[model samples]
Target: MGKLVTVGEAGEAVVLERLLAALAVPASVSGVEAPLLGPGDDAAVVVAPDARVVATTDLLVEGRDFRTDWSSGADVGAKAVAQNLADVAAMGAVPTGLLLTVGAPSDTPLAWLEDLGRGVAAACSVWSTSVIGGDLSGASELLVSITALGDLQGRAPVCRSGARPGDVLALAGSVGRSAAGLALLLAGGPELAEEVAPELLAAHRRPVPPVGAGPAAAAAGATAMLDVSDGLGVDGARLAAASRVHLDVDADWEDQHVLDLLVAARRLGGDDDPWGYGLVRSWVRGGGEDHALLATFPAGVAARGLPEPFVRIGEVLPVRSGWPAVTVNGDDEVVGGWDVYA
Candidate 1:
C-alpha cells in the first residue's frame, strides 16, 4: 500500500514539484499548447492576441465559498476555474490562460492537492490555454483563487451596460439546478437518492458552464452580457442598473429552462423547495452557481435566431423611477436570489 503524505511532511518545494507534475498536460492530447512560461517561473507570460486582454478573477474561501464536506479537492478546483473563465467569456473573449493561487493548512493531504492540480489541468485542457503561474501560502483553512485571461480576437468586449429598452433578454446554460442540489442536500428528503436526483447533486458539486456561449453571443451581436453566478434576480438587476433599463423576466413555463426543472421538481416531490413558490419556478428565479450566460440582444432578433443553448427568458424595458429594476412579470413579486450578505 502507498503511504499517505501530508503537506507538512513534504515541505513547499517537493509539494509544489509534485503538484506541477500533476498539472502538466501534453499539447497534442489537450489541443492546448503550454504557456510561453509556466509554473516555477517568477511570472508567466501569455500572448495577448489583438493587443487586448480580458481578465477576470474569483476568490473562494472555505465555508464561505464552498464546504469541504460537500466538495472534494477536484470539485473545488474545477468550480473555481469554471467560475472565473465564465466571467472572461461573458466579456466576449476566448480564455487563453489561467493563474491559480492556493492556501492550505499543513495538515492537508498531498493526494488531495494533486487531485486539485489534476482538476485544474482537466478544466483548462478543454480550451487552448494552460495555467501560467501561481503562488502557495499557509493558512488556517483551504482557499482557492484563480485569475483567467482571454483574447478578444479583435472583437469588442461586451459589458453589462449595453442593454437598452427593446433588447431581448436571453439566457444560455441553466438556472436553479445548483441551488436545487444544495437544497436537496440540506433537506435530505426521503426521496433524495442518487438515482432520483444525481444531476442536481452533480450540479452543486461541479457546475459546467457553457464556455463557448459568451463568445458566440458576442459574435451574434450581444449588446450586453454577464455570468449568472449570483442568480438571475441579482445579476439581472446589476445589468439593469448598469444599462439603466428594466428587465421583465417572462419565464414561459413551457420554456426549456423551466421544463427541465419541472422534471427535477417532480422527481423531488414538488414541495421540497427550501426557497418558495413552485419548486421549479423558485429555483429558476433564484438559483445561482450554475455559471450560465445571461445576455441581451438587439430588438427584432428572433428568439430562434439566437445561437445554440440560448433561450429568450425576458425582454428589456424602459427604466422606471421607483419600480424594481427586475420583475418576474409585470409585477415584482415572488422574488428569489442569492445574497452573500443576506
Candidate 2:
C-alpha cells in the first residue's frame, strides 16, 4: 500500500499544489549528498553532478487515444506514467520522478481521480519512483498529460543517432498485442465473446513498460535506443535516418499467428473484419500506446541481465536511398509501418 493524498481533503483545484510540498527526502547523486526537495518552494532542485537532466512528456485525449468503456481510471493512470517513463528508459536513463496534469468533467467522481492517483503510484513503484507534482483542471472530457524526469548516472544520454552499420537490432517487448485488442474493441456487439489476453488488453489500457532494460542496454553499450510508441516501420525508418543506416526485418508469420488467432476468435464470435480493415496492422506498426523499448546493439555483444519480453528483431546496414521495407519470408508482401501524420 502507498500513501494517499486526496482532493477531498485539499478541496478542488488545489490538491496537487499541496502534494508538491510534501515530497522531501535525502539521497546521493553522483557520489554527492543531496536532498529531494521535490516540486515545492517555487522550483525543485537536485544535485546536477554532471549538469544534465533528461525529460519528456506526453498527452492522451479521451476519444482520440482511449475510451472509458474500454478502460478504468486505474488503467489510464498507469498508462499515462508508463509512456513518458519509457521515453526516459529509451535514453538509458533511470526514471526518478513524475509530474502529472489531469483534466476531466466537473461531475467526475473524486474516487476516480483517487484511483488514477493510485495507478500513478503503482506504476512509479515499479521504478522505485514517485509522482512529485501535478496540476488538475475541469474539462469536458478526460485528458492526461504527464512529464517524466530521469538521471543518466554519468553516461552519455543515448539518442536515435547512434546506430552503426552491422549493429544487431533488438526489441525489448512483444508486438501487436495492443493492436489485436483494438481489433476486438471495434468489432463490438452481443456477439463479442472472444477472450482477449488479459495482458494484451492491459497493454492497450495500462501498458507496463520494461523499466529495467534501459540501464541494462546502456551497461551493455547499446548503440541506439527508443520506445516504440509509433509503428515499428515508421520508428525503424526514423532510426535509419538518424543513424544514416538501413534497418531490415524478415517478416515472420509466427508473430502474426498470435494476432491472427485472436482476431479469428473475435470473428468466430460473429464480428466483422475490422481487424483486417488495417486497424491492427497499422497499430502494430503505427500505434502509440504500447510503450515497448526498441534498441540497436553491436553485433555479437553479449547482453547481460535482460529478462523475458525482449528479442533480437533485425539488423542495421549502410544507408541507402529508398523506402525502408519489411519482407515476409518467401512471400512478396512488402508491408511498411504506420505514421500518425503521414
Top candidate on lDDT is 1
Candidate 1 lDDT by residue in tens digits, 1-342: 146488888889978887888778888888986678777768998888689989888989898888777777888988898899899989999998999999989999988889899888888887556888898889999999999999998899999999989999988888888887877766664247255577878888889998899999998899999999988888888899999999998845324566555555665554565433477766877788999999999866644599878888888999988888888766754356655666
The alpha-carbon RMSD values of the candidates against the true structure, listed in the order shown, are 2.7, 5.4
- Kindly report which residue pairs in candidate 1 clash with one another: none
What's the distance in Å from true for residue 85, model 1?
Answer: 0.7
lDDT of 2 by residue, 1-342 (tens): 133344444466454533332222222312223326655455555544556779899997887777777877777878888889889998988877777788877666556676677677667666677766667787888888999888898888889999998887788865566665665667652124236445556567777778778877887888999887765766776777788887766455335534643553445343465445344545455555566787888876735533334567767777655545332342332344544445
**Candidate 1: regions farther than 4 A off:** 1-4, 189-195, 253-256, 262-277, 339-342
Model 1 per-residue lDDT at 316: 94
Candidate 2 regions with alpha-carbon error over 4 angstroms: 1-35, 46-50, 189-194, 253-283, 302-309, 325-342
